[model samples]
Target: MDEHEQVFQMDTGDYLGDCDYIWAESERERLRRLWLHHAQQLSDFYIKNESYIAAIKVQEKVQELFADAEDNYFILMKLYELLNNSGCR
Candidate 1:
């Protein structure tokens, strides 16, 4: 299967089938923290490297923290789009 199909398939069992939701919130929080932490690390690295592209990418991910803070998926998607148009993807 293609990458998109593989990704969709990998997640299908979570919601499409009789799967457990015991760790869903915990997993999501874990991932959120991981992404935020890594974005900080990338910010530091980009500061040293002066990588404009990488900085923009890190900003895009940093914006995603608002998902947990305010559930602002629209803003997050906008940031993602901005980063994509910034040629950092």
Candidate 2:
């Protein structure tokens, strides 16, 4: 299996101790990844359509949802740049 599957399997294993907490954390991570993936896709579509403000709005929600994600900050900065500069290279 790939690394993520391996890690998930390991984390959920009974011998690891605190299975409930591990499972909850794993599930939260899974949902976070799903949310980030879809949010990025939607934002990309908005950007492609020249809707920078809309894209920024979507990413802002992502930022709030995943505050610890450093990439979210960079994404928002880039989006703001695009909005102000109108497509910076």
Candidate 3:
């Protein structure tokens, strides 16, 4: 092993994946995924009900929340078009 590797065993476990460190991060991840699922369901319901305008409005609200996320903006527009083309209505 290299000198640095021998000096410090990284797996000392003193601070590895501690509850305090992982709790908030994992919770955020879980909530983020749940939020996306509900948002998609809302859009799907709006499309199925033939309320395309309301679906777009929901997308707009999501866009506002993630205004700095260019990829999300693109996805929002794509979802809008995809929902519009869906034969659900």
Candidate 4:
């Protein structure tokens, strides 16, 4: 048997704590960069495997992830349009 009594933790953070949540510009940039990285990886894989259909789906999802960011709209729209216009749809 152990000498010290075991304890379990349930509360992670205080809901009424004196804390704040701020959405900073740098945080937005970081998230955009992360999503773009995943998009690039998926694009590369699809190109190498000729998985056009699957790639289109994944690309749309990536666009959705960045949908709230107006800056990303044009680029994502272009990609999807390319696939559709390329007779891959």
Candidate that scores best on lDDT: 2
How well does candidate 3 score on lDDT at residue 32? Answer: 54
Best by TM-score: 2
Question: In candidate 1, which residue pairs clash?
Answer: none
TM-score of each: 0.44, 0.64, 0.49, 0.45
Ranking by TM-score: 2, 3, 4, 1
Over the stretch 46-72, how does candidate 3's per-residue lDDT look in tens digits? 667767776676667556655675765
The models' CA-based lDDT, in order, is 0.50, 0.68, 0.57, 0.53
lDDT score, candidate 4, position 40: 59
lDDT of 1 by residue, 1-89 (tens): 24422332242222222545665767765765665565555555654565556555555545543435543345345545655776866
In model 2, what lDDT does residue 31 have?
Answer: 62
lDDT of each residue in 10-67, candidate 4, tens digit only: 2122332344545455665565576567665665566457666655655565556556
TM-score of 2: 0.64
For model 1, state the Cα shift of residue 57 in Å.
Answer: 2.3
lDDT of 3 at 72: 57
- C-alpha root-mean-square deviation, candidate 2: 10.1
Taking all chains together, the TM-score of candidate 4 against the true structure is 0.45
The lDDT of model 3 is: 0.57
Model 1 C-alpha RMSD vs. true structure (Å) is 8.5
**Cα RMSD (angstroms) for every candidate in the order listed:** 8.5, 10.1, 16.8, 12.8
